[model samples]
Target: MAFRPAQYAALLLGALTLSACARSPAENPQERSVIQNEDPFVAAMDEATNAAAAADRSARKTPSKPQQSDAPRVDTTAPKLSPAELRQRILRLTAGLQSAADTEAERVSRFLGVSFTPELMSIREGESIGDLEQVGSYRVSVSRIDRTAPGKHVRISFGPAGFSTGRPSICTFELAEFADALRSQGYDAGEVHLPHREQWGFVRYVSASDLTFYVSAELYRANDGTRSGKLCLADVTADAVKGRQ
Candidate 1:
């Protein structure tokens, strides 16, 4: 029997629709498992996770301790100068004074009636260098001379002098000016110098040696540049000189 063309077309369309309907809506469990386990993308993802964990571990590593710096230590020892040692220093200093006087005998004779001598001078312990007070005013003090000079040019202690309460402003005056000022104030004064940061000045006073006088002064420059002068007055004697009177 001969088939009709319209019936054949309808029959093919129906078959195509049926075939599409019959197709599975879900994938096979075994096949999907194989794809997930075997795919390079999955393997690469696992490798990336492991690499991240390793990097985290590396970042969490403990740091090393810092090294300590090397620096110099400061010295804090007080100087040791005993009575004997100080006496020796005084002897040496007096000898220098005698030599200086001998070198300028004529000048010494004119300025001071007597020359320098060793037996006429000595150093005694008076007080430690510290603060000073005078006329109800406080000052930083160093040392005090209990004796007097033996000649015109004397070796005076320069290491010990104290600062006045009114510091720097009063201290900046020239040594000569200071000496002049002290003299004006009725204090025996002389040439002044900074022997060792401590202010020291030379003073001249009447001596027992008949028409002779000794010269020595000790002064201190305060941190503020102010100065304090201490004059030592003595009478020059031929055999034994009178100490500070």
Candidate 2:
């Protein structure tokens, strides 16, 4: 029996629906084509998108070589001051001492060219300079031009004095002189003092500039008359004075 046109058309539509439902996922050419064309659509989205992705990759990548930081730099090669300028700087630093004793001390210290904080002077008188246990003794003198334009004299006795004879003398001096004296003597020194007091420590002199120097001495003692000492010298300059002050 021959099918009518309407029946044949209906049968054809049913067959198409059944085939579509039963088709394997791999056989879906339209779906596969959509996936295959996806890359082109993404690439054509915009020129900026590709450029931005490249830039991102570049930013995330590390440089094979070391890179310099954008920090401030110091200029270490500037011309230094002349001798005259250095002398002026020294004079400016020493100008503040008004006492005759202080002036002489400062002048001599400057002549030694040693940088120091300040002279700590202590003196004591006892039955014997050695009677004080753990004390040290040394002689110090200074010469300077006075306000009256005359040469002035200043002298000091340095070392550990008997507490009973006088108060313990303590003062801070410049580190430059202390270091210089140590270096001159071929002795290595550190900024820190020894944990225990030393006896007979003496600083002869330190050179700071052509005209400057620093000198110092220290003495340590025990209750049983045991004594030890230390000495320091330093060169004082404008920079040293500024740093200390």
Candidate 3:
């Protein structure tokens, strides 16, 4: 408290001189470490750490062999078929089915109660089929045993009548495609309009042949291009075709 400013400055210089005189030992090149502390355990840990780092940096990596998997990776993704492409395949399939049913009589015989693509179309005795025209996807299948008929073996023996099962199917065909498919087998389904079916699902493809197809396989661009198509294969007897409707 009684020290002068000049005396305080001299005391500070003396303390600094004493501190400078107390020198640290000259460091050994091998003992040099990043840690500058006096704690031997800490200094040893620092040396160990530096040694480990240097060893890690200089170590030759074995390039770890990619862990062998039981199964090799494969890209199983398949390209999706477009509507037009799908229509072509369906046409080919229809043609194949037609070829299977070789004779005209066979086509006429199996016309009412048979389907090529059974998943998209099939039937049994007394099983109801949906009529999209009359009841908005309402189905009324061929009665293999109809009590109303004389023999109870057929449904309709008259005008243009066929089957409809507009069940959502992966396989689909355009009106023209189906027409062309049928046409390939001598049946000529008349001009197919763009919007093949009416609002009530009534298709206007009328052909004068033993078997005619009125299938609504149009792709609705509004949705995911899913085709709820109606396949109507009519058997027009000579009497029915010759203005007998």
Clashes of each: 17, 39, 9
Which stretch of 10 consecutive residues in model 2 shows the poorest summed lDDT?
123-132
Clashing pairs in 3: 129-139, 129-140, 129-141, 130-138, 130-139, 130-140, 131-138, 131-139, 132-137
lDDT by residue for model 3 (1-245), tens:
12133432332344335435433433774444433455576566668888988888766464556667775433222224433443343343334322213222224224332222112222233322322222122222222222221111122111112222233332232344455665665443332232233211111212333322222222221212446344432211110111111
Better of 1 and 2 by TM-score: 1
- Per-residue C-alpha lDDT of model 2 across residues 152-238, encoded as one tens digit per residue: 333333334453233343312333454454455433332223334321221111122212112122332223322431232112211
In model 3, the Cα lDDT at residue 61 comes to 60
lDDT of 1 at 174: 37
Q: Give the candidate number with the greatest TM-score.
A: 3
Candidate 1 local lDDT, 95-200, one digit each (tens) = 2332323313343222322222222123311111211122111111111122232332223232322332323322322345434544553344333333243323
Give the lDDT of residue 231 in candidate 2.
Answer: 32
- For model 1, the superposed segments whose C-alpha errors exceed 4 Å read 1-200, 205-208, 211-245
For model 2 the local lDDT of residue 111 reads 42
- Return the TM-score for each candidate structure: 0.20, 0.18, 0.22
Q: Assess candidate 1 and give its TM-score to the true structure.
A: 0.20
**Candidate models: Cα lDDT each:** 0.32, 0.32, 0.31
Give the distance in Å from residue 222's predicted Cα in candidate 3 to where it truly belongs: 6.6
